[model samples]
Target: MTLADHHHDTSPSRPTGLGALGRPAEVRTHPLDMTSTAEVDAVRTALADAGLLGETVRFAFFAPEEPPKSDVLAAAPVDRRFRAVLLDLATGRSTDNVVSATSGDVVSTRELDPATEGQPPIIDAEFELIEDILNVDAGWLAALAARGIEPASVRAVPLSAGVYDYPGEVGRRIVRAFGFQQDHERDHPWAHPIDGLVAYVDLTARTVDRVIDAGITPVPTASGNFDDPAYVGPDRETLKPIEITQPEGPSFTVEGNHLTWQNWDLRFGFNEREGLTLHQIGFDGRPIVYRASIAEMVVPYADPAPVRFWQNYFDCGEYMFARYANSLKLGCDCLGEIHYADAVLADDLGNPVTISNAICMHEEDFGVLWKHADMFAGSAETRRQRRMVISFFTTIGNYDYGFYWYLYLDGSIELEAKLTGVVFTAAADSEYATQVAPGVMAPYHQHLFSARLDMTVDGVGNAVEEVEAERIPMGPGNEYGNAFRQKRTRLTSESQAQRSADGSVSRAWHIVNPSVQNSLGGTVGYALLPEGQATLLADDASSIHDRATFATRHLWVTRYDPAERYPAGDFVNQNPGGAGLPAWVAADRPLDGEDVVVWHTFGTTHFPRPEDWPVMPVEHTGFRLKPVGFFDRNPTLDVPPSRGGHCS
Candidate 1:
């Protein structure tokens, strides 16, 4: 039944029986909320006692939806449960054991597909081992000495998902070492590269594979003058922090995994692959999104040279997205009264490792939301825009990507990613370099990211409708036809939903529940608005093309499946081709009036400019899913006005 049809009141303060009559006014804690520290420890202890917590038999959090649908979760009894994914490293067999956190018992067990075992995340042990090799290994030390570099001057960071074409044993992690210059106390490491030399470490073998120097002349070290007080430019002075005070209290409240802001509510969680996930979202107690996450991202380098061609990487599938999370500093990554959420990741040995301040939640001023000046009335009305920002940053090799999910008072949601940090460079002659550096060529590349949005609309089973604004033909009506019309088409199946952005025309797709209707008799839905998109430029027959078939389409709609979390398949490193989005959608399942997951691909084609040298500024790109006919009118019309004085 539609929310409006049910005349029942569902406010949290007053209990109301629910069974399609209406849902709860307040949000409930999602079963998929991030596992807590005690829960992690308890599960670890249980597995340890059962002799399942070892290097070979490891335990990981298994994300699963509760038996009952999200719409009925409020009426259902509280059943706090967790599942532990047992992965056998030797045989690669996986099992799912449902762990009752409340009862502290393994309630049920089931076997999972062998391919369901997620790739081991890059852990502290891997980094520590590489550091030990650089310091203790005689050969590595000799190579550094030969380059006239001291151990203290060189800083090594893990370069994950490095191209590995070696004929090696199975289940070995090949980590590439990227060294940085650490000359001064205040110098940032990325400002200098020792040049040419790279160390390959075999984590499984616990040995340095080989140190090879590419045949290229070493370029001069870039300036680390960012910290130098004398090297100041216009607008270089640091600005003072503008504090946002809450005289009473915040307009939001967090209860366990559920957060309620104004009229919006959502449940958030963190996973190793997807990083931050928002589940069971609602506005005014009406279901909007069932689940949403940054599913997978592929960064492919355009250079065709031997070493560079294979440098293409699927960051999410290869290296765990959450393991590389940047522990955000209070005044740096976020501002104002910030709420921090820590993420717990399993180590190589399956122990729970907590990364503090991995996700930051805060509110920000988003400029003017709405303004009108009625000269006839001799007055103006304006409502200042403010948005809640949920953000996390991950440092993958030379690049730091800030992933932000913003919720606006206007019932709009935005997913934005900012790419900042040093560029992965190669030595080149001054003639070949035009944009990034004189002697160093910052290789042409594209960062393609896919956001997996599982929309439930009012509840489950939503349909996708593509709407395009087209100009009306002049001859059709035999009159002055300087007008446009909207062409709406419903994508009824999976194959029909796989679409590309037709940028020439104004178009948008919506996830709508056919049963729900707005006050104007329009289908209630959220519009998928793609901003910037960069398709894969690699040859269709290329290896990189096969690795990431999800990039071929701008949007992919598929039937919801818990196992199909990743776009580029489970294992992307050194993988010729296996299972991915194309293979998963080969079933051609029906999508209309079914649980659907929408994959939105947005990216940037980075042709590095000269200013990108040293450290590149943050390049922003992403998409938004805004409310269309979901509401009766402007959702922000009732927002309170700012009481602060305006500057003349």
Candidate 2:
């Protein structure tokens, strides 16, 4: 019988509702929610009316602060307010802090003030201007001709040329060109190479600063090797679309910016800073995490040569991830019945611009969640696993990072970061570029990213516990030395919480609410289960190390402070280093049974390989926040088996 044929049977495995069981009374549009296109345009008009428009002044979102956000979520009446950062780009730039603006009327007027130079949002217009310049570069065409390559055969991609402080330059629109081959009219232009040719353009001077043309290296060509037909397995050439059918329709509901799926509920919003943020996260109508987002990321290059020493990149702080958001396509980046979300941004003229399909939410069949077969009972039981995925992707220059938040059937939450796209390669000297190529070295680098998790486990008074499996001596209790004991240690303060991942022991950290207990007398909590290679390998004294001290350890718990958002202070591009996580944690604040924030750092050290040339395959790293004693029993045990029957 088909899966749907057995729907009439009232089996234990059959799910009742295809959508939310109940709606939360307090659930509504978040005030800190991303500024709408209409609101953005209105704000722009208001700023102009106030004489705040100039070439030297730029706009950032006026988001709601923590107090207002908390008040609104608590169902308490709050005045509608918004905050934004205005960057002063004038020469000399004597200002010590970022220009701040607040608006009581989101549509009309705003009050401006200067405050502690917090993390600044990137200039969106600059990237648009770069794209315009590269599309019509005569100099680039001539350079390609000089190298005996036709213009049509090459595809030039504009990359943000990092600031190195050249002699006497202002309003400088710096961009470098990386060319790809378009042999055989294929869409995979990343197959070929343009060697190492650099170009600098000044918008103010309206001139090309310099064109450094290096020696020509053999073009790395790829036409048939990586395409669909050849890349497929033997005898696997049919291109039929695999469909995911939800017989009862989707188990989710989206009303405005808020979404409810099964036992989980959350609000999603976008901004020109951190891209996507999940707010007011709840499970089974109870609050869990107040807010969760990717706070900041730093990708530091190891080569210290003059040409590459200053290659450290603070992606979230410097360029801002929102500017690089990719408009994902269906059946490519995601599958199933996809629900798309659009984002509104400002154009070069401070007008509203809409990016469609910027975010996608869908349900995925996550294989088998739980199964048990007993020969004595002559019975087999299993339930198909399912998960809800909320994802958005951003392509920052040469690399692409996909941010995903998953809600599992068993009350577990996972945050995943997927790294893909082309590697940042440089022209190498006669010294070997290793096995990849003769004159190209994909410099070794580390990508360290941290997520700000404001967790409220059954209200705000929560404590952290570090539990480890320790091996004891044989003399203890006159027992065998083979036995390992469970050691539970309470992290009473921030100083004790700032620690590294001890791989030698089987350990876990839990954010627990002592006031809430399960039937077993265990505290209600969620455990932080760290995964992947998360520690930063850089030296302690380096600039990268100093700025990203948050990366030194796998996890850190601190008392919640609104100002302490980003771990790598705000001005990360060529920063002097003395802000972000290290500065915040240096105070050693109390963390027990108070509103606390958890910072998780994870990453990888990439050493480029030959196959990694052109475009590298995607590599992933992430962690999970699983329910520990939060539930009285195994929640998934009651999940009904699939009507399609068991797989034997």
Candidate 3:
């Protein structure tokens, strides 16, 4: 059936028993009281303005009745004590509270769809809207209170649908409470929280009591002590005994020997101003030679008698002797000059004697010295006086993974530079604003900037593998890409504009340099051309220059090199150096072309204060380099950095 045809008449039959008994038979209905007075007027004005309250309109209120008794022979009387009023808009009879208390009867039927055109049913939609509006009002009310305001903890529960029986009065109450009018087509933003929930006015704090009676639990306090009880009733089942053990000593004794002047030799040859003393000897019976001063002065010695010590030593004499012999033979000083005399000596019968000098050394110092010796022995060109080197300097924050330096070495002209750390931008923090144009300052104001360098080595004009590397941020404010924001600035001017026929279109450009210092006022590094002219390059240009433009890009840092201009143990104040620039080289090596300078910096950008512990995050920064133009165009560029490999 069509929508209009589905409308069923629900008028109640005339009363019987009450009129027959002559019990003051006046039928009347009372008006439904709206929570607010303003809502009633608003509904009246709205209905009148919409032309729904004139001759063609009619409004009525009804309370549903109980089912009839089975034994009744006569029709039961309508419950006239339950009153309702019908409005005949045609006669303009719209008086307030005009219904008398003696009318009751309502029609009931199956539910019908409410989406009919030109005549949408208001039952479900109106109740739903009222509920939502009430919820929003409650939220606003809580917000207005001086205390007990909890935005996250607020909630709403609907009461009943019977309150909508007086639509006109109900509508007025809602309008007065929320300062808005109800319209099927227009939605108000303030009404969002109240939608689809029942509205209730708790004049006597009855709402809370009603809610409790309906079996809802109250919300727990946010700061209630939940941990105290938990600790008092700790579970013993989860406890277990912990075992401790004492640290054991070394497996064997570390024996050492000393060299004497007897292992020296005098040389008298042509053009010899002073005789050069030499020591010829054997290491565990293996022949070796060393300078007399190095042999006599560099070896360690103890006070114990040699034969007595050897006899009194613990078991495993052979193993101990072998370890001692191997360690002594391999030991060398910072210059890579092996002291063979310490491991060898003159035999009693004119044959070379073998001496043992083996002692455990600190891992860090030993590593440094070992590398120094290896680099010196491998390259003959750097055997003479070492040249001064230049290095890069940067302070990375504590959270940084590490720094990277880009170096270009082609067995010819070498150049080096570095880029700062990496920062990542998250979508949650990024927003699109209608007020600002896309790709403008507003979009990138807090955006993070990072660089990825891909270097390829070409061999015989053919492209080989490419090496990819990334630098990441290291300190506080790193979580939101703030670290990058502090070190770089986006060019928002027309300088980054692209030329068009009509005019110029603005394009975003990232310019990176040490000029953009962090709050600490210390910059990462400076850039200079081959001619020593300094200039800041665009981010893309910097990447390309570091990758393939230069013959060799040296990634150096300014570090305190104690051996550069002072004795081994001389004290020097920490400074950038007199010249403000110096050659960058690994600590263990002499500055030379044979070794590619891999630079690193170590220091605090800002001095620590008493408040900094438990060691606040410090800013540290550095760079990395891949061989771009270093080889013949492109070689095996995909090789990863070696864990134990030195540049030389």
Candidate 4:
């Protein structure tokens, strides 16, 4: 399903009279759909009715709603319900409330201790309070002035405050903040690092708790501006313009959020947490994936500098970076025939806001799908390949990430994350960083994205098996040499299934519906092929190791549980350790003949070079899912060949 749209007009997917949500009213809201702005007000009203929400308590987080049980989803249409978390500023306690949007009633409530369960995700209101908090604190201003940078030169931006063993920060809603010098009005702060100055702002108290100045390292004066004319003298005229025109228009059709292209049928939805998510993916009316999304990702820096050591960001869970998703531009972000879908989400004040053309969908010609030349028959046949692309881009701090989902003419699903942006910089003395410029050193980091694939190959009763190409020894049955076969091992349980990508052995994990069979009498399946890059470089003893255990392995298979959506647990803001996947799979749930979800960790470990300075080029990383036993034969035999159009 594709949602990448290039148009920023007041356009929506479908006509719906119900509020500002793009989802059509008749099309019943899927459990994976985004929480509507109308539902946010209904939830606030419902909480107030139960005397849990008021002036003293602030809405901390309304996380991505969890679905009902597996059976309930396959049954009749269900009513709309939501679960929200609120923090009492007076007592530093979080109360979880489940509200029914259908009836506008509060169904359940539970109070959690910040000391035990970690604090809720950072809210938008809390970020808004930072400027006021910093402006009032004279110490923060003095710290900025001490670095020879005015307080007005840097903005008081709030960041996801990670956890250490600090006694004062324990059990508090903390947001780590720092400053970057902007000498001019349009200066990019990322280029100039006001290093060694950090502040811990307590959101609950609405004050700057403390500011740490680890001796001011020289602020980088290099200009990081790439768009300005001052950076480049002239434009290159060597490259000519290429036009991609589908005069007949794209083959894909969209009705509301539902998308159908070639033989594939799927639906896509968006939320504040995860920008774009796909659901109900099927090929020729046979189910493949029930729900799929980029559930969580961690960007952990390897530098050990005090100001940079605690640099790990959970972009989706902690910051809800999707709120900052870019409204894609036409010729630049997408080309060819495009279909755009407008995304709607609630603002900090529970008001509806629409990011027009936030999602983009397009098609691209991909060389050839199949080709054959028969010398005996004096005939040649070739069929070109084309894939439908669905993507969205979001900017978080210094980096911008683009998550793309591509569906091909054949039964294949692929997710590609394009990384491009200015790299986070520090002073040039660190051993773990590369001095990209005279004074700017970019640290080494990894962007490990955990893709959650809720697969239902033919049905929910599916299992995962690790497939590897094993080399047979040169003996026994083979007296000569050259004997190799594949070894398939059914992952029976959760703990035993934790594995790494071994490209040396050509390893891949396959999700198969063992209960179903194809024409060859083999189990219907799809294979997950990873690029097999390195996992988290952080050791098990590090704090980030505990918070992002999902990155410890390339693959993790667990029985489908609606509650287990996030890989790094629910509250990853300031988690200590052992909370998410590591804690959930400790029970070692059996995965045989059960509905299972595959979390594939795929990313690149960046060691910045001189060419990566200023603005870095796009680096690509992703995984693929191809039909294994699901198809009896070639699925694209009916595809027509291109007509003759040659140029001299």
Report lDDT (Cα) of residue 225, candidate 3.
18
lDDT of 3: 0.20
lDDT of 2: 0.66
lDDT of each residue in 1-648, candidate 3, tens digit only: 000111111123223233322332333221111111122222233334333345433333211111122111133443322111223323323221221123211211121111110111111122224334444454444432322333332333221111122333322111112111212232211111221111233311212111111111122121111133442256558768543221342111211222221111111000000001122211222111111110000000111221111011100100111111222223221112222222221111111222222111111111121112346556421111111111212212111121112112111111222222221111111232111111111111110111111111110011111112223466665665434221222212212111111112211111112222334453212121122111112133222122111111112211223122111001111111111112222223322111111122111222222222222233432222222222233222332333344433
- lDDT, candidate 1, 460-558, per-residue tens: 879999988988778867468888888899999888888888766767898898988888999889999887366888888876787788887888999
Candidate 2 vs 3: which has more lDDT: 2
Q: Which candidate is the best by TM-score?
A: 4
Question: How does each model score on TM-score?
Answer: 0.82, 0.80, 0.14, 0.92
Write the residue-wise lDDT of candidate 2 on 1-648 in tens digits: 000010111112212111131211232244555555444444455555555567766654443343433575577643333344454444212112112122313233333221223234335544444435544677766777777787667655544344444543323334444666667664555545666555565533335666656656666544323445555347655788688877787889887778899889988877656778898889888778988989888787776654345456777876766655777888799887888887765543455555567789998889989877999998777788889999988877668889999999899999889998777665454232333544455778888889889988988888888877898778867476687888988888888888676757867788899788889988999988887475777688775676667878888888888777778775554344666877887788887788889998887878778778656788888888999888888788767777776554
> Which segments of candidate 1 are over 4 A away from where they belong?
1-30, 55-119, 131-172, 176-189, 194-201, 207-213, 228-241, 349-351, 375-379, 430-438, 476-481, 644-648
Where is the poorest 10-residue window by lDDT in model 1? Answer: 1-10
Q: List RMSD in Å for every model shown.
A: 8.8, 9.4, 43.2, 4.0
Candidates sorted by TM-score, best first: 4, 1, 2, 3
Candidate that beats the other on TM-score, 1 or 4, i.e. the better one? 4
What local lDDT score does residue 305 receive in model 3, on the 0 to 100 scale? 23
lDDT winner between candidates 1 and 3: 1
The collision pairs in model 1 are 435-610
Over all chains combined, what TM-score does candidate 1 have?
A: 0.82
